[model samples]
Target: MRYDVVVIGSGFGGSVAALRLAEKGYSVLVLEAGRRFADHELPRTSWRVRRFLWAPALGCYGIQRITLLRPAGRRGAGGSRAGGTGRGKTRAGQSGGRAGVLVLSGAGVGGGSLVYANTLYEPPADFYADPQWAGITDWRAELAPYYARAKQMLGVVDYPRTTAADKVMRAVADRMGAGDTFRSTPVAVYLGRPGERVADPHFGGAGPDRAGCTHCGSCLTGCRVGAKNSLPKNYLWFAERAGARIRPLTTVVGLRPGPGGAGYLVDVRRTGAWAGGRQTIAADQVVLAAGALGTQRLLHTARATGALPAISARIGALTRTNSEAILGASVPRRAARRRRLDFTDGVAITSSFHPEPGTHVEPVRYGPGSNLMGLLQSALVPGGPCRVRRWLAALAGRPRDTVRLLSVRDWSRRTVVALVMQSVDNSLTTYHRRGRLVAGHGHGRSNPSWIPAGHRVVRLLADEIGGIPGGAVTEPFDVPMTAHILGGAVIGATRADGVVDAYHRVFGCPGLHVLDGAAVPANLGVNPSLTIVALAERAVAHWPVKGAPDRRPPAS
Candidate 1:
């Protein structure tokens, strides 16, 4: 079948592109690799633990596991596919191997928006002024209108400061003497009048009506309360209404220029255990919105096969992990207050503090079923060969005991989970190897500005609130983790310096464009979902449709 636009991947970038293009009267088809999930389909209790974590054999969640290998000398090894046909399939059909480094990301309809903490902040001014961004377009002016559009679409709002957790965090910030940096995080949620819901209120009755946020702490576990404003509830939902067909559990495997036309042919597979099949889609325009890892892998494979050799060499360069860390502490409550009620009940990240330059700290809350508290307890136990060893031992021995102890203790009353981040510019690159995206390892210089700032905030928390010091953790490392990953296929002035031009069009390919985080030139020092949405809006706006065109002919 043919579409005016074929969008691969349905995360922030893909979602926005699909919606905007469809709104412009284009016949759009969105191919997503993961299955569509409703709130009920998501696990709300411990009984459904398997659904929360990814495992190929057990009907994995959308998060893909990645490995970071040391760069292969000057000349890297030729990339190849590991197993059957390079097609996505049920767990039984997937290749059996482990990645050297494991990076987690969401798949399915909403993409990372499903699992990400909805924190939205603007990029620093210096980000737009950088030489890397100057050549593509005047990012500052181009992005302004779109950012406003994205904000209105996502229902971005600030915390009410009414929750007890918010007050405590503010008090802690004040005691630290760096209280001036404390502010309500701008989140994508509604805070309007009671019982009255309106969709697309900002667009004059064109969007969906999102019920206001109830402040449920279960945003991570899937907001069953209809409060947390996720993309599925807004943009993607509206896009479907506007006539875009969202094909979930459909993974695109290959892309080749359309037979004698200004378009391309896309190969896709329906993934599942019951039954699966393959199909081809033809499109006049293709927008690659798959996140950094997914898009890099797809583009690399396409380029390597002579499908599009004109693809710039800088395709997988400037990758950044947003320079984030998860630092948290536990506050033990008196035995009398332990069993009263669930303090975590209506709290969805209520406060934040920046104790020093370049550092950001915020309260992290977990639902009843989240094992985060147990993880924190394990990290706190003293004594072991090393921090890793100690953490392993704690994980094995103390998780249950600590949970039982905390179940009776009022930790939520006195404790606030904090995440500390520095605006350090360290980054890594990603490339395709054996049909998969792999990150190259090696730490760039750690920015001292973030470290000192982080330490200052940590010290204040420990001293003022009498909270215990904790360490950082990510997917492979037992430290904290972040959902924001940016860069890779960056935008540049010329094909030699970057993959796409200022307009987000491929350096050489005319009808091909990349309109997602992959186009971001630098880390925004904040969650990137909102920025991606805005950028996508700007991209589609630049390419206004001139009525619908005829479908491209089939391949010979």
Candidate 2:
């Protein structure tokens, strides 16, 4: 059977598309390459190591190797697969590729909303300043309503400052004279009296019944308590109720545009820890919402093999990592072991700091069970012969010092995980090599303005909290890791400069569209998921449904 639309990847973008398209009375088939998890099936405690972190045994997390190549698309430093078992199967159960795509995206039914920190913010004005974007769409105006719609649907709320971590961080900021910089961040968490269920509090009761946050601190562990709002709780949930079929662990490998005016043929596969199988899907329109890494790999492979040769030569050009850096500092030794310090119990990201003009800093928390502290401490321990001798001497003189020092201490009181994001724009491209994605060349000059600005904020955090500043020690040659990767297959004025048109449609491929972070024209200096959702809503509004006239007239 054919579908009106086959959406690839079920993350934020695809989830919204599936819901809206299905609500319009179309047969929408969502193909997700990851497995599905029920609310009850999610891990309850961080100590449940297998389930807490994305692992093959838990049927979550994809272990794909990711390498960063130079801008010239030539050789650069290669990296190893970071963590987790390189096991499990796709929906088709196929395996055996280097795990270079180490993104923390949601693979199952809910998508990244399930795994991501629930920080949601509006895109800044600079986002619409691109000349290329002005020709195709008026993003600022077109997306305003959709942004409000998405916020309500996601149950976005202000974080409560109840936890010890929140209190201490605020005190530190106040003491350091940067009190104005620290404020409660907007989050997509349920915030009402405990166990009180309300139906669509944001909407006019058209959405789901959401129980308020219990402050379980399990937001990162998948919100088993139903307090953390994710797409599965609203959009996807509503879509299913409206008759959309969400096929998890079902990976779409290839696409063949149909003959004449027919739609497209989508090649499918299965994945998990099990064996593999294959199938085909016929659809009149295809929405590629497979996240940046997944979609780039698929489209690059298709172009290499001439499957869709009309794809622009600029397919993988203009990529961006959103100028993000995950800088963290451990809590002081005295505060380490307090059970009441439960970092995971409050909002995932409570307060933010803007010490400079373009940079934004926010507090992030990880449960003790996450072992993130151990990693940070290990990295902070000074190295070299003096360090080794000092460690040995300390071990002999103060036997338990090392372990005790590493213990969960009053540090959470003074410590805050500040996620530094900047408006200074920088991006990397993508290319296919031996059937995998390697970072494209042209690693632009590190945005000097943003770096100093971020450092100033970190210093302010240190001064306010009486804590040490910390982050990954990258050598002069090493690149930083970013969670917010965007661009590539960007929307451009013409097919010559981009893969898609301003309306996000593939120039030559009439019915295909890309509606995700990949299509963003510029860095919004903020978390992009909200903006992406709004853009998808706008794209769907422009979709030529049964009753609508085509917005763009056909070739003359």
What TM-score goes with each of the models? 0.80, 0.82
Worst 10 residues of 1 by lDDT: 81-90
Q: Model 2, residue 421: what's the lDDT?
A: 74
Q: Per-residue lDDT for 457 in model 1?
A: 55
**True-vs-predicted CA distance for residue 255, candidate 1, Å:** 2.2
Q: Taking the tens digit of each residue's C-alpha lDDT, what string does model 2 give over 242-356? A: 7889998677789887767589989987764355587888999899998877777778887899888777767666566665655655545554334333455576677775655
RMSD of 1: 8.3
Report the lDDT tens digits of candidate 1 across residue range 1-556. Answer: 9998999988888988888888888899999877777766765732354555545456765333323433433343232211102111112211111112234466667887776667777776756764556654678898899999988878788766455556656777787786787787888766565334556454576655555656656566565555566778778988899899998877778888999856999988866535458788999989998787778777888898889887877766666555555554554444314534343644456667766544567776666656433342324432112545655676578665345434424444444566655454444556676766665421232111123344445555555444554443322232224445677788776776778876678877768889888888765666678888888887777666646552332111
Model 2 clash count equals: 37
**Local error of candidate 2 at 307, Å?**
0.4
Name the top lDDT candidate. 2
Number of the predicted model whose TM-score against the real structure is largest = 2
